[model samples]
Target: MGTDETTGAEPRATLEGFLRARRDRVRPEDVGLPGSGRRRVPGLRREEVAILAGVSTDYYMRLEQGRERNPSPQVLDALARALLLDGEATDHLHRLALAGGRRSRGAARPERVNPHLLRLLDRWSDTPAFVLGGTLDVVARNRLAAALHADFTVTDNLARMTFLDPAARGFHRDWDRSAAAVVAELHKAAGARADDPRLSALVGELSLRSTDFRTLWARHDVRGKSGGAKRLHHSAVGPLDLHYESFTVNNADGHGQQLVVYQAEPGSPSEEALALLGSLHTLYPENGPEAGAGTRTGRA
Candidate 1:
């Protein structure tokens, strides 16, 4: 999403943007609207969306134009259905509508990692584990986890590394999928803590630096924490396949802090790779080398 030329600032993400983006992605044929020839807009027309949502054309148009901020729950539900929004997308729509069309841009309190959690991460010698802050900032990481993500110039911020770091594109075997996932997670975080200045700044920086980030951010996809397998190519250990599980730390000093742990199956090649990574990690600590060293400070 580009900025308003008049303002010379990135347009604040609004409910209107969300609606327009989603609407642009849907087609008339997909929603049972009769195909039209040479339409000016990309997706279904505003009138078609209004019809599908059982609302007046003027009312729906107002919603998209930002003339109307809040929409009733019934209207939102109808719009969600009309747009064929998935559970995550539908939830995000509700959040945006209830938020009065704009993400909170207020300053947020600082986050601190719990010492006990750090100790726990340390105890997981074989497994790769790290704690992430609200905006997916790497709050803390164990030795193995540090080694696992050693390729990136800055491992402190996952979103930054995924978009800004060239090594990240090659490090993540499924580069496109990983990029989308990071943006979706960031969207979910923004919905919950939009007022956080750190999050806002991170979004602004990425929106400006990377066109890819802008394109994906405009998609408004929201995703929650869940375990999944990943394929990563490490320079030292070659390719490795591992599964990770994420756990939320409730009432932690940091908002939306999550603990992510990566593991490989026993007797597998990935397991051997993990062992090698651990051995190498002990010899070359994450903080020793300038090139491989990652920042401990919070960037978001």
Candidate 2:
């Protein structure tokens, strides 16, 4: 989502741009209205959209114009259904609405993990260690995570896969449980930042596209994703039952970043598989000579 001439760096304008683009794609006839004469704005009228979404024309106008940034989850959903956005579009909208002030998408370009922490991953090659966001976006994963949840990182979001990806249906042994977790994380984000325009748009898009998402969201389940057990069927290692621990890193700037680690039982085939992954990880070649090894802190 690119911003334009007058838009600020607050991320609100990018969301506005997306909404305007989607708003343009839908013709009047697509939603049961017969085409009349040449019109200025392409799709539905402001009043029509506002009425359909159960919002005031002035407020919706401000939203479309990027003047207003706060819209509740329910209002965003109403707008999404009215716009007829697909699952991916819906998720994008939600991410935008929940992004707060962060500009670039997908977790502020993803802060790099510490070298020592990465070393830990290198050591535990038989285990799975990856960083996942509150949305279960597989931020980064080691060899074992790639093996266990093969398709997790391929997509931008876990919820998007639950609705759109074919492999998700097959790969996730407990599909319902996975789906519930996805929705719960999304709900938590929504609760945390009720005014994020991007988050609002994403929720709207998902609700319109997937009936399953709609049903799950309606349950009002809110929970943070931290630790859990995942039963994985690796094409190479067969089946593995592993427990996971997910914790947030205290970014120097106070951003809530997390590091998720997964481990298998000792003397298990999963552990052996992890070892193979570690061996492979050690050969990655990018673990070059430490560049900033000699910095000294001044005494207070």
| Model 1 segments more than 4 A misplaced | 1-11, 101-105, 283-300
Clashes counted in candidate 1 amount to 0
- Alpha-carbon deviation at 240 in model 1, angstroms: 0.7
Residue by residue across 167-267, what tens digits does model 2's lDDT show? 67666677788788888677666544445454555566566666777667654445566888877555544566677787876641332446767778888
* Highest-scoring model, lDDT: 1
Number of backbone collisions per candidate, in order? 0, 19
Task: Score every model by TM-score.
Answer: 0.89, 0.51
Predicted structure 1, TM vs. truth = 0.89
